[model samples]
Every structure is written in structure tokens, then in C-alpha cells.
Target: MQLNVERGAPATGKTIRLIQTARASGQDEHQIITGNAYKPADLELLVRHRISRGAKVICIDECSEQHIECLQRLGGRLPDELTIHAVVSY
Candidate 1:
């Protein structure tokens, strides 16, 4: 599992690069999510569900501090086999 946290300014093509990288990695299952689409708790639940469904990679675009905090809360709960990519823009 590889967790890639790409943090930088907006309009930097972070999301684009993330998707390209995930596709190039040949992962069978990858999901892309927008930060504002869900609250912290909801995001955690969604991630857990995806993990249970054998998702290999999960990408979060425009990721916020709340998103990071939520994932941090999951800590030991997150699957070791799943990779998370968070593209956060300031």
C-alpha cells in the first residue's frame, strides 16, 4: 500500500497527476473523491466500505485538514492493504 499526500497550491494539476499515477500503477480498483462532498465521519465510513470491497486505491482531491484528521482518526482501523492518495491545495 502506498499513501501519497500531494500538498500544494490550487490549479496545480494535482488531481490529474494523481489519477494518471493511479492508472499507470495498474490498480484494479481506484476511486476518486472530492473533499467537499462528504463530512469527516461520512468520509471515514465511505473509506471503510471501499476497503471492505477490496479497493486498492482511494484518491481525494482538494483534500482539507478535516479529511486528513478523519483519516488519522481511522488510524488502526484502516486496512493495511489499501493505499490512500490525498491531493490537498492551499
Candidate 2:
């Protein structure tokens, strides 16, 4: 599992975007996941979706601490391919 941290993940207003709508390739994939980081259930579900669907990257829009914690807990499940792009705003 490789980890990539970046700023400015896609989101809808104050809420995070919570679904994988597209596939990225070759140096273009920073990693993305969909879900409201503030919501624990959403974070868990979104992360699980990535695992179940075999997504290579996890991108959370408006990522909160819960999102990061969720990743730390379940990230190992992803095994070989895993990328995380966490967005934070100050």
C-alpha cells in the first residue's frame, strides 16, 4: 500500500464527494475516495467501497480527523494497491 498526501480533493460544497466515478492512470492518479470525512459511517463505508471495488487510491474531500483514523485502521486491508489523497482546509 502506497500513501500519497495532497491538498484540494474534490468535494461538493462543505460536504465531501463520496463515490468513485472515474478511473485514473499513469501519473495522473493522486488517489481519491468519496464520503464526508466528518461522518464516521461515511468514512468507513467509503473506505470499504474502495477495498471491495479494488480501487487503487482513496481521496476524501474535506477530509476530517475521522477519515484519517479510518484509513489508519482499515488501510492495511487494501494490501498491494492503495493510495490516499486527503484534503484539508485552513
Candidate 3:
């Protein structure tokens, strides 16, 4: 159960690296959480749903204005057995 956050400038491959790092530990079961696909208000519910479905890695895309806030809202809602890799590139 490792929880880490990686952040860098946009287009620096930070997100890709995080995904790869997460996959190294998971069995190809990573969930990509993007703001474009889900509303800001529904991110928590969706992330929790994905996690419950056995998502080992969570990638919070940097394209959303509330990405950081969304990450913060996830404070203590995740399972200890899961690995979270959220990259914020502003």
C-alpha cells in the first residue's frame, strides 16, 4: 500500500511515468481519472467506484482546473491496499 504524488510541468511525461510506475506494481489494472470525462463534483464518487472495482492506480489528469482540489478531497477515502499516483502539471 504505497501512496505517492508526482507533479511536474505540463507535457513533461509526468503522467505517463506515474502510470508506468503504478502498472509495475499492479496487474494492468489502472484507472485513469480525467476531469474531461467526469464532472468535478462526481470525481470522488467515480474514483471510489473505480477503486472498489480493483483499480490499483489512480491517475488524476492535469487538464482540469480542480485537479488539485479533487485530489485533496480524496484525503482519507482510499483503501490502504491501493496505490495512488496523481500527477499535477499546472
Candidate 4:
């Protein structure tokens, strides 16, 4: 599932709803969770979701390529059996 948050609105509840809907529809099997740095805590929750679903983790950050690269590298190092993914904001 792909979620495109428009204008960075603080729709925390909406974001959670997106997650819930994705899970219910079996869209959480594989994902690339992306979010900006301003929502670090929320991004963490996305990571947890991917981990729980046994899906690969890919985080996208528009603020800092360095941070995104670092996160991708870290994701590459995880055990092959574990598919939890996370992208840390810059």
C-alpha cells in the first residue's frame, strides 16, 4: 500500500487509520514506509508494523539523503528472516 500525505498535515488519526486499513486488507505483507523527519515517532510506529508483518523495510526521507542512506544500510543488515523496515528522518 502507498500512502501519500499531503502538505504534512498533523492527521495522526488519519495515518493510523491508513495503517489499520492496510492491515485489514492484507496490504501489509510487503511495504516501503516513508515519512518525513518531523514525524519521527510516527515513523517508528510504521517500522513496528512492517516488523510485525514480516515485510521488508524501506524508509524514504526528502530532508536528508544521508539519513535515508544510513537507514537503508541498516535495513540491509537485518536478519534475512526478519522483514521489519524503518527509515529514520534526517
Candidate 5:
């Protein structure tokens, strides 16, 4: 899987723009999941579900270190075909 991390200060509209672009491109909103530093397990579950639903890319807004940890834990567990984009807000 390919992981792209976009980091910036909070309320910078990065997440919003990502959502808008995804929607404009006909991607399902469900494929984009909002996350935080505290919800690693939840994020993992959501990613798994999205992949099962045939989503090629999964977007996570407000990502954090915990989210990275979750991804690390899920390393090699998720399909290699998936692409993950994480928008991290400080």
C-alpha cells in the first residue's frame, strides 16, 4: 500500500479540500474517515471495512501519531493494493 501524509496546522482546509476533491471525483464519502491521535483501533477497523468495500483509496483527516502507529501495526496486514492518504493537522 502507498501512504501519503499531508501535514499542516489545524483549520487549514486541507481535510475539507480533500473531501471535496474525493466527492467531486465520485469517491464514496464512506471511504474517507476522520481520525484523531486517540483512535488507532477504530481507524484500523474503518480501513479494513473500506478495503472490503472495494475502496482503492482511504483518506483519514486530522491524522496523528496514533494513526501512524495504527498503520504500523497494520503493516503487512492490509492489502498491498490499497492506497492511504492521511491529512494530519497540528
Candidate 6:
């Protein structure tokens, strides 16, 4: 499962929600790794790692259409082994 949040959006509760849900489900300390990237390579490792660990990948702070487009494109090409959730804020 992957989560992607758009820029300028309030993500105040997203991480908490995931943590709570994961804990309630009896999952171990859900490895929550949050980060940002202006380049594809910068996010590659983290994205792949999360996917490999069966963890959701989230993208936060996407403010521009170009950013959204890049994220969408990347999502489309990501390995089928992973699921992504994206929250875009206009």
C-alpha cells in the first residue's frame, strides 16, 4: 500500500491514521519513512524499499501540476508489487 499526498495539503492526520490502522491490525512498528525529492533517483530507493517491505508509499506536498504529473507517471511505472496512494491538492 502506498500513499501520496499533494503539496500544500494538510497532512496533519495521515501518518497518525496509518500508524493507528497498522497497529490495530496487529502489524509491527510500521516502518514509516517520510521524505521528499525533486529528482526521480532520489525517491527510487525509498519507494522500492517500501514496496519491498509491503509498506505503503506516500507523497506529500505536491503543489504544482508538474509535480503531480511526475508523481502520476512514476506511479504508473512502479513495480506491480507495490500500491500507491496519492492525495493531490489544488
Candidate 2 lDDT at 65 equals 64
Cα lDDT computed for each candidate against the true fold: 0.77, 0.54, 0.64, 0.42, 0.78, 0.48
Task: Estimate candidate 4's alpha-carbon lDDT, on a 0 to 1 scale.
Answer: 0.42
Q: How does each model score on TM-score?
A: 0.83, 0.56, 0.66, 0.33, 0.79, 0.45
Name the regions of candidate 4 deviating beyond 4 angstroms: 1-31, 63-90
lDDT of 3 by residue, 1-90 (tens): 454666677889886776676567653434556546667668767777878888766666653557556656666666777666666666
lDDT of 6 by residue, 1-90 (tens): 343453334665554555555555444443433333345455555666666676543433322455445656676666655544433343
Q: Between prediction 1 and prediction 6, which has the larger lDDT?
A: 1
Span of ten consecutive residues with least summed lDDT in model 5: 29-38
Rank ordering of all candidates by TM-score, starting from the highest: 1, 5, 3, 2, 6, 4
Q: How would you encode candidate 4's per-residue C-alpha lDDT over 15-61 as one tens digit per residue?
A: 45555544664556234344554354455455556556665433332
Score residue 36 of candidate 5 by CA lDDT: 65
Displacement of the residue 1 alpha carbon in candidate 1, Å: 6.5
TM-score of 6: 0.45
Model 6 — which ten-residue stretch has the worst lDDT? Answer: 29-38
Please give, for residues 2-81, the per-residue lDDT of candidate 5 as tens digits. Answer: 78777888888897887875686578676577786337887888788878988777777778877977887786888888
- Per-model root-mean-square deviation over C-alphas: 2.4, 6.2, 3.0, 8.4, 2.4, 4.8
- In each prediction, how many residue pairs overlap at the backbone (N, C-alpha, C within less than 3 A)? 0, 5, 0, 1, 0, 12
The per-residue C-alpha lDDT of model 4 at residue 78 equals: 50
Return the TM-score for candidate 2, rounded to 2 decimals.
Answer: 0.56
Residue 17, candidate 6: Cα error in Å is 0.8
Name the top TM-score candidate: 1
